[model samples]
Target: MAASEKQVVVVGVDESDYGVHALEWTIDHLFAPSMPDYPFKLIVVHARPSAASTAGLVGPGAAEVFPIVDADLKRSAARLVQKAKDLCASKSVHDVTIEVVEGDARNVLCDAVQKHNASILVVGSHGYGAIKRAVLGSVSDYCAHHAHCTVMIVKKPKAKH
Candidate 1:
């Protein structure tokens, strides 16, 4: 890959408390120093299930409720993206884009990185250990293990004592 070509920097955009911080740190720590001849781009992905049609539903059916919930999730995703972008702009970062993906966050982010041939996958670590992660599951660990590209696991800034 040439230095002038732009590589995709995909990040999860959701209400997760650390998502915004991950976005900010990525722009500052990764892209700013490594921006090639081309400007960097960010894809903010929010995943959810696709809507199911309820036109044929009667008194109570999954159809009526499913679409509304999915719609709400997309809206939330949009908000996260906006907040991230706004933060970036406030800090003078550019070349950012937001997107919503309807699926599992881990699967969606991984797929996107592959599809975009991403150079690095930036994710936040909620500090789940191996045993706990095995049961509860951690997106950061999943991406680090499954992503075809390099993965950057970001932990929350250590709290002040």
Candidate 2:
């Protein structure tokens, strides 16, 4: 594929409302335009769980949480991507390419951008402070600075008072 015409989009997914917002942005701004005309390829990614999580599930009702019995992070990631695709398809946005990539959100996204020759990278911002985010550099911040293509960070809506 020529570097000139190469185009693709990557989204970071998690349980956060921010991720959902990013999904919506991708649908409306990117995917919606190509729907039913020619299928657009979208890469939906989810961060993997930490190694310590394997020690055992946390909180009450852990066993019944996922409720799938053998549900794993990889499986959950795949499911979330499919769920996004299904959402788009229901609205006639068919032919989305889904993949569940594991690892750090920023790295995974950057890697995907390079791998698929993506022209844009989208992520959701938690709107945390520098000190707070310093301990955890925001994925949006990271991709915006490092990605090969344009980066769009979806800011989470303020909560209702």
Candidate 3:
């Protein structure tokens, strides 16, 4: 890999424990000391529900119902991004970028993969049960099938009793 061919890995992130676990796993498994050097860069992507979705949730006139909720959402997204950056920094992974966009999570992640020309798209599993998955769907599941690049779904390590 040359200067123009930096290796980029895009990972979906959120405030969830699984999200943090995915980021940590990527650093440990992909960028560990034993890996070959290629100017690796990690891109953290988070997707917030669209403003329309928020508006709908608040009610018909909710678009103007509460500006505070919109503001709060933005702040929350920023905080999550910052936390992810800090985690990367602590792990000695400095070449990191944060992307917080409002849209469907699956689309946001897929778009990031194409925009970054990422060779791998990493996401964490929430381990939703059959009922929940049928109702709410899974981000990792969508990404695995739709991402332009290779997809890695990181699962939380199970604890031993």
Best by lDDT: 3
Q: Provide the TM-score for each candidate, comma-separated.
A: 0.79, 0.75, 0.88
> In model 2, what is the error at residue 119, expressed in angstroms?
0.6
Per-residue lDDT of candidate 1, residues 73-100 (tens digit): 6677677767887877776666676677
**Tens digits of per-residue lDDT for model 2, 24-71:** 878887666545454346777776664334435677777665444335
Range of the 10 consecutive residues with the lowest summed lDDT in candidate 2 = 48-57
- Considering summed lDDT, which 10 consecutive residues are worst modelled in model 1? 49-58
Model 2 whole-model lDDT (C-alpha atoms): 0.73
Per-residue lDDT over 76-98 for candidate 3, one digit per residue giving the tens place of the 0 to 100 score: 88889888988887877777888
Please state every model's RMSD to the true fold in angstroms: 4.2, 5.0, 2.2
Best by TM-score: 3
Q: TM-score of the candidate numbered 2?
A: 0.75
Model 1 CA deviation exceeding 4 Å by range: 33-39, 49-60, 129-132
TM-score of 1: 0.79
Q: Which wins on TM-score, candidate 1 or candidate 3? A: 3
lDDT of each: 0.73, 0.73, 0.86
